[model samples]
Target: DAGVTQSPTHLIKTRGQQVTLRCSPISGHKSVSWYQQVLGQGPQFIFQYYEKEERGRGNFPDRFSARQFPNYSSELNVNALLLGDSALYLCASSLEQPRGNTIYFGEGSWLTVV
Candidate 1:
């Protein structure tokens, strides 16, 4: 099966702009998650969707939002991007097993703001 994948491996934007990142989960996966990793920091959970419904959310502002599709793929959108928003956005997927929480991450989408 194909592993999790993301598009636009890298991007550059200016402050106050908007950016949309895409993610496709592994085959047969039902859960997709989004995370943000700022420089020198661990990846912070942004959103987790299972069965096309939101399952979890992180401590981020409304500027950050995401949604999952029926096919289990997901997209993350950031509005009014700031220099502080420049970081790696990663997507993960799991089997929706609470006991076996093995999430596979993609190479990530790098966003840079000036």
Candidate 2:
């Protein structure tokens, strides 16, 4: 089975623009989470979806949104982009089990705002 995959490994956008990033979870995984990582800091949680419904969200601004498809794939959308929004967007998938949700992350989509 393939690992989680994210699209547009890299991108460049100007301030005030909008961007969308896509992700496909590993087979059998039912939950997808999104995170943002600045160069030196750890990833900041953004959103999580399970069974195609939003399970949770972070303290991000209203401009950030995400959704999961029926097939478990997911997309992250950001509007009114700012230079501060330039970071690595990560996608992780987890199999919610009795033990715990074991999350696996993809390389991430690198977004650079001008």
Candidate 3:
């Protein structure tokens, strides 16, 4: 059984461009979450979806959006990319249980905006 998988291991973009990142959860997982990690800092939660519906969101600009499909796969989109947006985008998946449940993370998509 594979853990969470993310596409496009690395990406480079200019300011004002847009990018989309994808993720697939492990089998039997029903929840997918997205996070942004800057250098030397912890990941910041971007969004969380469960059963194809959005359950939570973090303090990100409107340019950041995400959706989960019926199969529990997810995608994260960022528009008007800025230099500050350059970071590692991580996807995590877990069971739709209590808050303390263990969550699995993908290798992450590295994005650099110049």
* Deviation from native of the Cα of residue 75 in model 3, angstroms: 0.3
- Number of clashing residue pairs in every model? 0, 0, 0
| Position 110, candidate 3: lDDT | 98
The number of the candidate with the highest lDDT is: 3
30: Cα error in model 3, Å: 0.6
Q: What TM-score, computed on C-alpha atoms, does each candidate reach? A: 0.95, 0.96, 0.97
Tens-digit lDDT string for candidate 1 (6-95): 998999999999999999998988999899999899999899899999888899999999999899899999999988999999999988
What lDDT tens digits, residue by residue, belong to model 2 across residues 30-114?
A: 9999999999999999999999999889999999999999999999999999999999999999986213757999999999999
Score each candidate by Cα lDDT.
Answer: 0.92, 0.94, 0.94
Which regions in candidate 2 have their CA more than 4 angstroms from the true location? 97-99
Q: How close to the true structure is residue 13 of candidate 1, measured as C-alpha lDDT? A: 97
Q: At residue 87, what lDDT does model 2 achieve?
A: 99
Pairs that collide in candidate 2 are: none
How far residue 55's Cα lies from its native spot in candidate 1, in Å, is: 1.0
Model 3 residue runs over 4 Å out of place are: none
Per-residue CA lDDT of model 3 for 27-109, tens digit only, reads 99999999999999999999999999999999999999999998999999999999999999999999873289999999999
List the candidates ranked by TM-score, beginning with the highest. Answer: 3, 2, 1
lDDT of 3 at 55: 92
